[model samples]
Target: MKYPDLFPFSWFKGFRPESNDNLETKSPLRQLADIISSSVDQIDATFKDRGQKYPNLDAPFDPTTPAEATALSPEVIHCSSLIVAACAHLSATVNIPTKLLFDVGGGFHLSAALGVIIEGNVVEILHDHPSGLGVYDISAKNGMEPTRLARLLRLLATHHVFIETSPNVFKNNKLSSMLDTHKSFDTIQSKPEDKYVGTSGISALFAHTCDEVMKGSAFLTETLTDPDIGASGAVEDCPLAVAFKFKKSFWEWLEEPRNEYRMNRFMLAMEGSAKLEPSDAILRGYQWGNLPPQSLVVDVGGSLGHIVREIRNAYPGLKYVVQDRPAVIESARQIWEKAIPSISDGSVVLQVHDFLKPQPILDARIFLCRGVIHDYSYSVAKLILRNLRDAATENTELLIIDTITPYACLDDNQARVGYGIMGTETLPPPTPLLANLGKANAVPYILDSQVLVVLNGEERTIGSFTELLKDSGWKITRVFTISGSSGKQILAAPV
Candidate 1:
């Protein structure tokens, strides 16, 4: 049985997925594994930092009251952090003049915040522990003032992360949705009827647009909403990349902190989402025939061309063309030319084309898009799909690789950043919401709501994607699974 896409989704209880190991259903186990991994120490230190006596190992995680289980209730703290992150997102919404200054300031604050969150102390521990040793103990020994810690924890709470025993208690109902990553994804894909895919978890919904997509909207939502924050631009500047508005002094402090780990974590967190959908996995096993011969794949916005390069090498006769924004394509062209002479010669064409506009190549048999189309307003993706459809012929194959939210009508209810709203020409209309967004498919509608709040765009579900294709003039052939439970390699054709 598939979980239905229901609003105010409540998978908290009485929820089931068609497949027992379905990632959405199975992730809690994985999270438990990760929590138990090294984080147990972090949890231990957290209790120490909070001055709570460690619970006996055999003690049940059950705490009579939320405050009673500090060590056992890391999840509660995580739930609280969701609020802090949500509110903290406002740091980016300032006008370029401010954004220009704020990111540098914000970055430092965030780094400090992160250190405090992870290690329970904000001293030079992260760097001093060159071996990454037990610096948590060292920091604790050195002495962290109580008043400062309280203030810092309070700041963290503003981001929506609340500490269990802290004097501060957050009241935001919505913050719970975004705190636990697994819960957040379920909420994003949940429809009005599917409690499993309910709206309670906001993390995935927040991730789609609110948290990482853009600076403005994320920051503005928090800033405008905050009572103490000084004047920020009116709400209109929320999503724009007006990063130059902040002070130069802020930028000066910000330049050095842009490290590799930070860049990769934040970047991949936003783009290569945790939920690996079947569509993405399916792209892995396909027979490309021969490579370095014909351009077998066009990876639009394919970052680093890692996937495309793999496909190219796997089938030496087939060549690859990585079409992305100017920066990405140009960078790829130069990097490949230097690394692999063959790719730089002529086999790979790193062209610049916006998916929201007309697709540059229509002749390729399989036109593949993975983790690309979900980055914009729905209206724009349709334009891109419409272009692809207009570019296709009877034999031309359209391979759209992305996460497909569990089909709402079916009893399946798993949701992870997958929106079926690409206008893929089939699967449309389960229900509607809001006067402006109109009726959308189960997963797409939820993703759309997220886009409205966070980054001003969304992820779609299979049904919405089908509808979108139809709207843009295409037809769905099959929605088949690949390796990952969350992803799918969607097959469609131009009508």
Candidate 2:
């Protein structure tokens, strides 16, 4: 199969690949690591300036009394914590090249192949075999070579995907067991009726990410540099479109008859992501119980009504209408009717509606859009918000549930100066760390890049979100951070 073109530097005239000798000096991670190392002195100086004895850098700083609090500025403690966190980030970022190199060199293929192997009951056979299956035995069972299989298994084991017990012998571990097709049997009870190739949630998600998303990611630079598509926010100009040389948007491309299997896998991956994501955040983050009796909540772009169903179970007083494309609505109708018959009785309505178009439902109490806006560009996101804004009354609340990409150094006093952007509040860290939680917010940053590469979209900063909402004639009322989860809930109302 033809892969998308790898990131080409030809478009960037002056761009030269950094050599190993200069990589450290040129690395942002190295700069961060240096900052962390130098911060220790600043911590000591702050203590001394405050007429307090400096705490040993090697010792843990635990302030128990008022005197201790006075001795150490909250800044010092925060900086110390940040140092620890930054070190970990530096380590991880430095090692990223190894992982990237592997991915470039058939890592995705290896992972998918492994998923297939585990899906095929090869792991179960090995488990049952007791002595552990050798390369020859496993290869014979799967119709592959002993040497190649051993090498692949060993490479995977290096990353803890499986256990290579005593060199050639291999066995499934906790991590690898997740790929087992029967893993869901205990929870699902019955076999999955879906005809998707890989039924395992993780397997499906992994396969989809590696097989589809990775292909698009490879040509991200090429997509950006193409004169016809440079910096275009249109979905048709997205990296995925450019990579596949498709004239249609990502959704339209997926709708093609030739991409049936790909579509199924993509849907399965979404389902899988839903399972892994903190869906309960919606339940805990919002006050659904506070809504008036029989208030209608429209779930915009809610695939298969999964989120609505979960919310409904918690707050049954509120009625729900799950809106999506016709096919998704049909699938949702089938799934919900079979699982929740009452959903068919108008209590939980499945509406076949495109979010880009004006919302047909009027006067909805709540318009909940989760994991939707990040799939579009700023222009498209504005269009979506505007569509909702038109249908929404003054009382209608627009709850956006998605990742709120945090800005770096928001807590720094200098950084906040002259930054009059709304929703850019400086969150106080527990002294001595960088204000934006530093490495803790790494996933959101990575996700921001993923959205950019895949959809010509973004995981917006609070400021960006505020700007987008303001432009669409809506004002953010409040932002709620879901505890123990990366998802955030932004509540807005029409201006």
Candidate 3:
């Protein structure tokens, strides 16, 4: 069987038992395996030492029992999963010669190039001059050191971001071409005299993730161990806040005028994520067509009315009221005016309202909150839910669109026995694979950590959600999955 060149590790071809004889050898593969073994051993020791520190994460690993049969806490299981992912990444890095160095160096060069490209419009210049520009000329135009800039471009060329045809000439490729600002507007969000220029949505997301998110993540361990913040559930005490030494919450910090550019990038990142994920899942998975004509739907904390607009386009007869913060609502109104003409006639109503406050809209047919609750801790989440509940009539339906975390165990029975009421059911994988789906669930697991680091929030298990809704005077009725999406539409009603 042929495997992609991107992953050249022979172990990925097929699983085979490791020979005892190779353990003592010093071959590249053996060295890689030894490194992984040593790393796992170290991690195991660390977990054992600190296990008592976090009672919530104290799940023992029983080698005597099969992995499929053993029960692990979500925290323990998630940490173990990360270790496994790190080992795989290390193995791949070591097996592929120069890959490790290239990746590290590429990140530095790419970050530098991104700064220059965004400020000097380097990509736009390259787009116009496809024949290629001399290194000195390009460097001079961008106000950079010629030799250093040339080396950076050459390094990026190895990854196909640019092409270095000769000693000093360079031209953009498909990857580098994307950074070019193609829009007619001079500044982000079309704000006149705004120095922070705009780029494509995806490009903005990449820049935001690489420059901001990664910087905050670098201090994760320190943040997690801080006495004042380690166990705090407040969003203001999260890892990102600790790393940045901020007195305000993440959202509050973003609202500052100095961070307008960053806020725009963050918005674009969310928009890009919505495009990639199945934003249409809620529209299609629910019984929207069955609703009476002119039925009202309230979008709670809806940002820029993106999801609401999509729903209106599909079901024109239904009406929507999008509620959010005052500033956000004003921005949404402007966006709707330009992109959604129906807003003027009240088909789409933009209202300024905070979700934590009592929901003023009462007796609406549906109260939809997408990608909102996950940004909050359980206490805040309950408040938001309770507010909706107070405003809800018997006929009102509550729809929460978010990722539902799955357990690592093979069966619901084991999960129940191990985690009791906190455990949700998990499907078994095919034979020879780990019961937890291993690398298949990496993205969601990582996203779970991201929420913790950024907002002291979390992705929830089905059991967790059930418990949460029950406390808020609501009960989950159904969970709808979308094809090719990691998100789920959870339907509930007031109990």
Top candidate, metric TM-score:
2
State every prediction's TM-score relative to the real structure: 0.48, 0.71, 0.67
Colliding pairs, model 3 = none
Q: Where's the lowest-lDDT run of ten residues in candidate 2?
A: 1-10
Task: Score residue 202 of candidate 3 by CA lDDT.
Answer: 58
* Alpha-carbon deviation at 26 in model 2, angstroms: 25
Clashes of each: 86, 9, 0
lDDT agreement with native, every candidate = 0.46, 0.68, 0.66
The positional error of residue 222 in candidate 1, measured at the CA in angstroms, is: 10
TM-score of structure candidate 3: 0.67
- Lowest summed lDDT across 10 adjacent residues in model 3 is found at 1-10
lDDT for each residue of candidate 3 in 1-495, tens digit (9 for 90 to 100): 110111011122112334546544555444445444543554455456654322221122222333212213333343344345445545554566687666654564566566555555456556657678888887766566888777777767775677887898888765676565554323332452333234335566666655666566667788778888777788888878877889778889899888877887778767666665544656767789888999899999987888888788889899899988888888888877887675778788889898889999886999998888788888889999999999999999999988777665455563444233222333343222345545535566667777887787888877678788899999887776655455677889899
**Candidate 2 versus the native: TM-score?**
0.71
Superior by TM-score: candidate 1 or candidate 3: 3
TM-score of decoy 1: 0.48
Whole-model lDDT, candidate 3?
0.66
lDDT of 1 by residue, 102-139 (tens): 64457445435534433332222222332332322433
Which candidate achieves the best lDDT against the true structure? 2
Error of 1 at 56 (Å): 14
